[model samples]
Target: MDFRFQSASPASWADVAADALVVVVTSQTQRKLEGALATLLKEAVAQGDFEFKAGRTLYMHRAAGVKAVRLVWVAAADESPKAARAAFAAAFGALKQGGTRHVAVAAAWEAGWQPAQAEALAAAAAEAAYVYRHTKPSAPKPAAWTKITVLGEKAEAKGVQEGLTRGAAISAGVTFARELANRPGNHCTPTVLAEEARALAEEYGLKVEVLDRKAVEKLGMGAFLAVARGSEEPLRFIVLRYDGAPRSKAPIVLVGKGITFDTGGISIKPAAEMDEMKFDMGGAASVLGTFRAIAELKPKLNLVGLIPACENMPDGKAVKPGDVVTSLSGQTIEILNTDAEGRLILCDALTYAERFKPAAVIDIATLTGACVIALGHHRSGLFSPDDELAAALQASGDKALDPCWRMPLDEEYDEALKSNFADVANVGGRAAGSVTAAMFLRKFTGKYRWAHLDIAGSAWKGGPAKGATGRPVPLLTHYLLDTAAAPSRA
Candidate 1:
């Protein structure tokens, strides 16, 4: 969608010619006050039998004296961030439902919206308008509105333009992530994901490398190979480097688990909703999505994206229960369950990240179902050994509105992962399963500062709205942007 910014007020609706004009109203009585558009909106609110409440939207068709085809009034609860986001989403949703082709937004400044808030508004609009029809036999109907104009005061033009640019980048990233995750397992295999990464690199002028099975075997990635051995498709160790800073600077490394189709291997999951396992590669998708945004924004920081992409299928060659495998780091893991395979591939990737001597490493994975039980679908579970990194991530999540609850990663949780045959056991029983998974990966990340995002809960939804949510992308992007804005490290 195309977004344009205009320095206009609600009273100038007479001059704005569009399919729809959206204005914000704080409360029911606010419409009855002053302003030319206010009087018209008050009349419409009284005659059209509409109530003005937070997130409530009322529409009028070709209202008298208004040049637009429709006028929409969006209720704002207050000036708070959450309310503003909801209000924008509601207004955009209403416009979409009304089948308005072009829209003009005149409510962004109502709650004293700043650049950040404006960014949030545009992001929310893009998210609300997103629809996935890739699997359909034919393309879905075209979107009603192809362009959006945000009306702002003259003084806010620069900030609004910056916000719009940032918002568009983020929205595109989120949509890309969702598209990758929503594809069927057959269509979005490990090789396909690597190709997508390569395309992204080429388009954005980033450096790209794909390590095939032969190269992977040469590097002694036994843990990663164990998971890949079960699949007919070739494994791809995908790496994307964005060097916005000098080569001497230590980059931020991001490791993602790329299990394209997790069938739980020998330790199989139940047949019910098993198809949704295609979303198991959400972490990898988010990493690629973040790279898309970073390439567009060109944040002044070097970044490395590492994805251990493979499928986990059940086969005679698949790693069975009680199999012990040596990782690239020379750390042996006793795999009590093949279903716990995300960490297996990720552990080796984390070890490979050490070669970069990165200042920080963050791994994103749909690693555990237990995390869903712990945090549900509302928030992602964050685990980090370093308090500073944890605080930074939490702050980023909060600002982006993609919240994550910090989970405990105490040494005590490591007791459950002890194994007599190997250095560690893959599964740590049913108790604190999520924490144990983090602890298992923690062993390979000792060389660099690391954090783990257990996105099992927030990666996708179930039932009617069953699709990838493109989560934690906002959080990761915000963190990187904030890091880029900070003083350069020596």
Candidate 2:
């Protein structure tokens, strides 16, 4: 969908041509409404038909005074960007299944209203309208929702326009990630993922390199290759570079764990919901998603993405429990359980990131169920020894409304990975599983400033709303933008 800003008076809202005119309401909303719309809202308030409570909504079809086919009034918690996002999303979601093709959104015009509010609205609308139909041949056709016009003062066009552009890009990235992650294991294998990366490279002029098994083997990625042995599908070590800045500048490196379908190998999970394991590559999806957005924005900073894509299945050739493998960092790992495969691939990828001489390295993975238990579905688990890096990520997550809860990464947690045979153990028992997983990856990241995002829960929902959340993409994008806008480091 496309979004733009236009000047429209409150009285003129009655004459606007649209399928739906969404009026955003805050605590001070009543006083801002004008003409027939004001009278309509006042009557609704007096008759107890509507209130300015958050999430409360009122929908009218061809209301007596409005030219639009429908009018949607949604109450935001406040004028804040986050609230606006949720409220706008709710409004659009109400119309997603309907015939509403064009929407006109108007909020109280304030002198100091940040464009972030407009950005929030654009993102929320796009996300709400997204419907997956790639593999569903019998599924209904895509929604006709096309253009979104934000009613604003003419003086505020430039800033709001920029925000809308960014929001659209972010939403597109989120949608792309969701589509890739939503695909079944058979449709979205490691090789298919590499093809998708190449497609993105062609479209955006990015530098993409997909390493086959032989290439990965040549690179000495035993930990990564071990995970691919169980599946018939080939493994791909995909690398993406966005040269927005000069080669003289060091780039931020993103490492993603791409377990296409995890059957737990020798240690299989319960059969009840093993199908959900297709989402094990949520991290890889987010990496690709963030790349999609940054490549579009072309922020003034170089960035690189690494995805160790494969499947974890049970086979005669599969790496078994108690198997020891050498990582790209030359460190040996004792695989206590084949189920702990995300870290195995990620360890090798983290080591590869060191070659970039990166400003910072962040590895995202659905590495631990413990994280789901710890943070629930609300926040991703963030673990970092570097306070500055962790703080920056935390701030970015907050700004993007994709929050992360920082976990402990003290030396005490590292002790859990003690191995009797190898240098480190793959599984750190049951206690503090998330932290131990981070600690295991930290072994390979010692060469650079690194952080870890354990997106076990935040990656996707499990029950009724089972789909990829396209997290960390927003957080990572915000972090990149902030990093670019920040003063150059000496």
Candidate 3:
């Protein structure tokens, strides 16, 4: 999608050229708009054609005194940041039904608009315009709308433009992640995901490497390989590097659990809603998504992405409960439950990240349904031993509106992983399942400042709106952008 900011005064808003014009009312109650349309909006409220309630909107097609073919009036309580985001979201939701290819938005709080408001508007437009039709070839084509114009005060044009650029980049990354995660398991295997990474590297000039099973065996990634034994599809350990800074600078490394399709391997999940297991790779998708955004924005910092891509399926060769496997770090893990496989793959990947000599490393995964129970579907569960890293991530999530809640990682939780035969048990008992899973990965992250994001709750929706949310992409991107602006770590 293309985004632009136009400095249009209130009086000239009605004359802005576009297929549709969306006007936001900052006043608590609906009142007159600017110019000839001032009384027109008041009359709209008086006639009950439009309600004065927040988020209420009125849509008019070929309305009188409007140069545009269509006009939309949306109500907001105020021009506050929260209101701005909600108002734009409502405006775009209303526009979704129309074929407005070129949209003109005349905003009120928009007069004093900041970058946040601009970013909100652009991101909302992308959300409204998105339609998934990749696997469904016969699905209807998306709307022809390709351009979004936000009418802002002349004084704030530069800031608003900057915001639009960021929003466009973020939304694009989110869309990419969603598309990859939405694919069926057959079409989106580990090999396919590696190819996607290779394509991204080629397009963005990032260094890319795809390691096959034999290559992985050489590195002694026993835990990662044990999970891949059940699947007929070959596994691929993907490594991506974006070097935008000097080699001496320690990069921020991101480790993503790449369970392409999880059937729980021998400890197969219940038949109910099993289809959603295909989304087990949401963490990997988010990493790819964040990379795309960073590549476009070109933040002045080095970034490394590691994905231990594979599938967990039931087979005679599958690793079973009580089996012990050694990790790349040479730590042995007893598989108490084969279903608890995300941490198994992630643990090796986390060990692999140590080679980067990263300043900080974060691992993203759809690690546990326990996380979904703890945080519900609203926030991803964050676990970190480092307080500063935890605080930075939480703040970043808040700023981007992709919120996360930090869960306790106290040493007491580490007791759950105590193993009878190995250094640790892959699955702890039912109590504090999510925390224990984080604890398991925490074992391998001893060499770096590490944080873990359990995205099971926020990664995808299970019902009618069932699909990937492309979360953490927004959160991660914002975090990296903030890091790039700060002084280099010593």
Candidate 4:
């Protein structure tokens, strides 16, 4: 949505919006806005149906003398911008970011907003809501809602609602991502996953392409197919594309691992807490959810999502330890362990990423237990070769309250993954398991500025028997928006 300020008479502005916030300062109170107020710097006790209770909100309809929407930040006579923005964000469910309040005033219009701008407002607002819900340690002061008044005509109401609607859409996407991450492997199989993706695409306008066993084989995704061979259900590779951006620009590529169920193949994962393996596909779900947001907001940034969906079960056809498989990139991998299947699927997906030649490639997976050990459940591990891409993503996460910790991709770890039988080994031993896993995938990224997010701890957090955590959706969506809005770089 295009956001701008206008200097119009109260009569003209009132003609635009039916209900508007009026500012008025009364008595000994400082400057404040009252409902469709008469005075610009008057402080008056909040009255009418719109009461200003501590930590709650009320709305007001347009009244005489009101020129534009005014948000009343009721603080203890003296409140800082931080406190005011917090209250304001909570009241309207807006993300606390620069230009949000100003942009939102105009964005509230019922129409005249581009899909991208509309979605950005929603994404930002949803992010704010998520952060508010997660923050703790309340202060001993009264809270107040920040009010926003619409000053445009009825035509602008659509734009305003559109901004709010976008926020809801992003929330839905994040919720879905969290759900997939939290589900157990027994319930989230390949068939069930295919059903989920198809349902979302059918419900939304997004396009989905699910590649079955034969199709996966045709693509020469042997590494991914090998991981699924052990399972009874056939493997599926799902591709979702949303083209809201210009076709000339390279689309943002999101690759996720959709391991419906992982039993560590023939190498076999430990029996303890195998149930959590269901969330192994958290990466795929995140990409799916992100695509959902893109489709809803219709951002002018082309997005392509790839999911190498499968299960790593230990059965007759399951690829065993010491097995050799060729990735789509033609690089061979020596399977040192069946439990290290995430890298196998990711390698081929990275190779598949070559098809799109994306401006950047981001892949998320619950690939290692060591990552959880390192960062715990508070943050996901972010490993990226590009500083610019990494910084943009980190900033996005900060705004969304989905924080991440940057992990080192030390060249020293690469030696642990060397394989005599193939170009690389899937497992890099016990020490630095997470870093080694990243190194294994880095070999496939080639020249692309790639980021590998290890969501193992963030995806599922409980005791030994914890459920899926459904993490990183908001962060990814935020990053996409930031990248889309940034100026094109060479």
Q: CA lDDT of 292 in candidate 1?
A: 93
Give lDDT: candidate 1, residue 319: 93
Judged by lDDT relative to the true structure, which candidate is superior, 1 or 3?
3
C-alpha displacement of 230 in model 1, angstroms?
A: 1.0
Cα-lDDT of candidate 2: 0.89
Query: Worst lDDT window (10 residues) for model 3?
Result: 27-36
Query: How badly does each model clash, as a count of residue pairs?
Result: 0, 0, 2, 33
The residue pairs that clash in candidate 1, if any, are: none
How far residue 251's Cα lies from its native spot in candidate 3, in Å, is 0.3
**Better by lDDT, candidate 4 or 3:** 3
Candidate 3 error regions (>4 Å): 29-32, 488-490
Per-residue lDDT tens digits for candidate 3, residues 184-271, read 9999999999999999999999999999999999999999999999999999999999999999989999998899999999999999
Superposed by TM-score, candidate 4 places the C-alpha of residue 113 at a distance from the truth, in angstroms, of: 21
Please give, for residues 205-313, the per-residue lDDT of candidate 2 as tens digits: 9999999999999999999999899999999999999999889899999999999999999999999888899999999999999999999998999999999999999
> Cα lDDT of all candidates, in order?
0.87, 0.89, 0.89, 0.67
Cα lDDT tens digits, model 1, 1-490, are: 7877888755575568889888766763363334557667667677866566788887778777778888887887876667778888888877765578888877634444477767877787888788888887575554577787877678888887888788888888989999999999999999999999999999999999999999999999999999999899999999999999999889999998899999999999999999999999999999999999889999989999999999999988999999999999999999999999999999999999999999899999999999999999988999998888988899989888899999998888989999999999999889999999999999999888999999999999989889998887889998999898983421
Model 1, C-alpha of 408: deviation from truth (Å): 0.7
Better of 1 and 4 by TM-score: 1
Instruction: Indicate the worst ten consecutive residues by lDDT in candidate 2.
Output: 107-116
Stretches of candidate 1 exceeding 4 Å from the true structure: 28-36, 97-99, 108-111, 488-490
Q: What TM-score does each of the candidates earn?
A: 0.96, 0.98, 0.97, 0.70
